[model samples]
Target: QIAQESEPGLAVYALAAQADMYRWRGDHAQARAVLSKARQLAEEKGLDFEQRGLLPVAEGITLAESGEVKAGLRLLSDGVRFLEQRRAKRELARARFLLAKAHLLAGDKPQAVGELRRALDLAEEIGTHQFAVVEGQHAVGLLKLGIAQGVAPCRALAEKVQQLGGLGAAEVRTGEGAEEGAASRLEIYALGEGRVVRDGHTVSSSEWRTAIVKELFFYILLHGPLERDAIGVVFWPDVSAKKMADSFHTTLYRMRRALGGDVVVVEGGQYRLGDVDYWFDVEEFEALVERARLLPPHAWQAEDLWRRAVALYRGDFLPEVQRVWCVPKREALREMYLEALVGMGRCHEARREFEGAVGWYRRALEVDELREDIHRRIMHCHAQAGRRSEALAQYHRCREILKRELDIEPSVETKGLYERMAGKGPD
Candidate 1:
């Protein structure tokens, strides 16, 4: 009906509406084409700012659905700026809705929620039914964000979704419920190549008798066989020494029995996993670290090995377990992982792999924001790659963070690197 209106300036609005309809129907290519025509027509006619602002948003939505997520996000952000400039609440809300979806697809849920909340506020201001519908969809996204943050509201949100008849209710329910179930289960992982099966079925360590035994196995694999005292301190820190030792012996006996007398040994008062064809994931991660550390400096394989090591670290070491003994080990392993990332970034920088090095350095910073060395490395990599603008931006960002968080200045090395990049120092 809107498209049938024959008014001169209404054509662009008509095209935008049609494009939105197509977009909702999952015909992204057609939507993009229509939006492109609308944008061109709007510009040629010198249409009002309201009609002109929808083009970038429609393009962004099309690009996101077409697998150009990063580009789509940038475009949507641009569209939001234009809408805000015009103070067009309706167009702004629509653009923000698209931006939220784009960020959600990019694994940036926190940003998505912020955009969605703003969109909802605009929707309320404009009294639009479409915004109300999107608000309902945003609820599901909010539920996902809650789950990712490990908040208790995740369960409540899931239940609310079940009651509301939203599109992703089943998915949210199943994904969160499955995660909760797996989290409660005591599973042991073998870290190696090839498949191992027993009686034509894959072997599972969850069939073990107790959670403590499984935990002990995980610890040994992660920390490379701790002494009895260390193990006692970690898992049973609050218990009496005698009770802790007794509990450790009991858990060890169960683990040994579960492995069927074939795969565990005690050597020099330290319990070790026996030589087995299959390796645990933790063991494989440790081996990768060792291999990367042992590689000749500037070896081509070092970055590849380091990437594999980083990939294996799905989250913090044993995120499910939070004992006093585990905290130090977790922190230590995290530091080691961040350093490995820094090493890989430096290696890549030396080889002129600027983008790859940037990725590694960014990941290192994500893992340890306090690591001034990584900040300097990132600044240096950006500068050396002829990205002087980005280098300057990074310097400002580091300076702000240091001032705000630590009340300090950048190190002399960092200042020197920045000065060189800015062409203000020794050539």
Candidate 2:
């Protein structure tokens, strides 16, 4: 900004630097706005290639964040080579940081971690630990992915993240990064029956001080940070305001006691579950499904990703919760689970393993038997496997379910498929 007045040419570099700062802070719209100014200025001034290279790396990181992983990778990879040619370790550190974001977005956890390690080393070598600290979310997120992938967390990196403050900051500052061990790490299994486990021990019913306390734990975990008044309404709107206050505080205290004092973080008049390096099953389950979406739909990696996702699903999300707010969440998650199952089935069908394909499609139907598409797929599988009688049986069953449950006849597609198959008889 200062260079814009005294030296407009240098403003291009200033804008690139500003764009990166915005990207690190997750203000991508602002970052792009900055990048646009930089590009315009560079073009108007007829800047050299070296002067414009910084813009691509910054733009590539934003592009990656916007889900254009392939295009982003091309630019960022070019950025990496550009920095390497110059042997600009500091700029290369920034490129690694940028590339790490792209790689993580591309679902390449190992490569993301490798980029992060180099970024950290380069930052340290260049005495930019403060810069690393400012981009703490990137550090913490990649570190968690590494841990999930069986890579150990580096204490040195964790310290820089602590300086930037967030959930893991407390643990690192307390010098309990590793020494606290996995035993203290809570795993909230909200996907199915909603259980909490720690240290290989399932927290018993007695562990929760009261029923509301357990309910509120899920509320915080799922809904994220919420205001006290808003939460009071959700959990105890029926009671008098004074009574609601008493009950809310009581439940909050019990929650803290049962789940550790630092587990609940209060900030900006909102409460959020924090301070611990805990795993929420819902997050991992959703992440796997999303990562699968990033890959080619029919790729083996996508298939395997769905398999892992569905395995963690266990059942519908928080089935016991009857809150109105949870209903849509449960329905949405069930849809994702169904998608994974159907994806697996299609993968099998693509391989001409009709038997296995039918099995997976059947599982999907079991989750929600009203799925006409799954029913049709099963029929296709049967016909593919030359099991005409079973194919006919599936059609009859689909007809009955649609009739009884939805009070509707089979669609034209279903009817047409059955007609064609019946006319052919056995293959």
TM per model?
0.46, 0.56
Highest-scoring model, lDDT: 2
Q: What's the lDDT for all of these models?
A: 0.65, 0.73
Task: Give the number of colliding residue pairs in candidate 2.
Answer: 0
Regions of candidate 1 where Cα sits further than 4 Å from its true position = 1-210, 220-250, 256-258, 261-278, 294-298
The 10-residue segment of model 2 with minimum total lDDT is 174-183
Cα-lDDT of candidate 2: 0.73
Per-residue CA lDDT of model 2 for 305-409, tens digit only, reads: 989998999887778777787788888999999988998898898789999999999999999998888999999999989998899899999999999998999
What's model 1's TM-score? 0.46
Clashing pairs in 2: none
Task: Kindly list the per-residue Cα lDDT of model 1 for residues 1-427, writing each as its tens digit.
Answer: 3533445467877787788777554455567678878887777667767354677777776666444556788888988998999898987987886787677655566787677668767877888635435343433544455455554434444565556675355655544422111112222443222122422344345645566666677677657566888888778889988667656655664454344222445566676765544445666677888888887547878878887887776667666664554677677668778867887887888788888888988988887676777877777777777787998898888888888889999889878877877889986
Task: Give candidate 2 regions above 4 Å deviation.
Answer: 1-183, 296-298, 424-427
Q: What is the C-alpha RMSD of each candidate to the true structure, in Å?
A: 28.0, 19.0
Task: Report how far residue 196 has shifted in candidate 1, in Å.
Answer: 12
After TM-score superposition, what is the CA distance of residue 420 in candidate 1 from its true location, in Å? 3.5
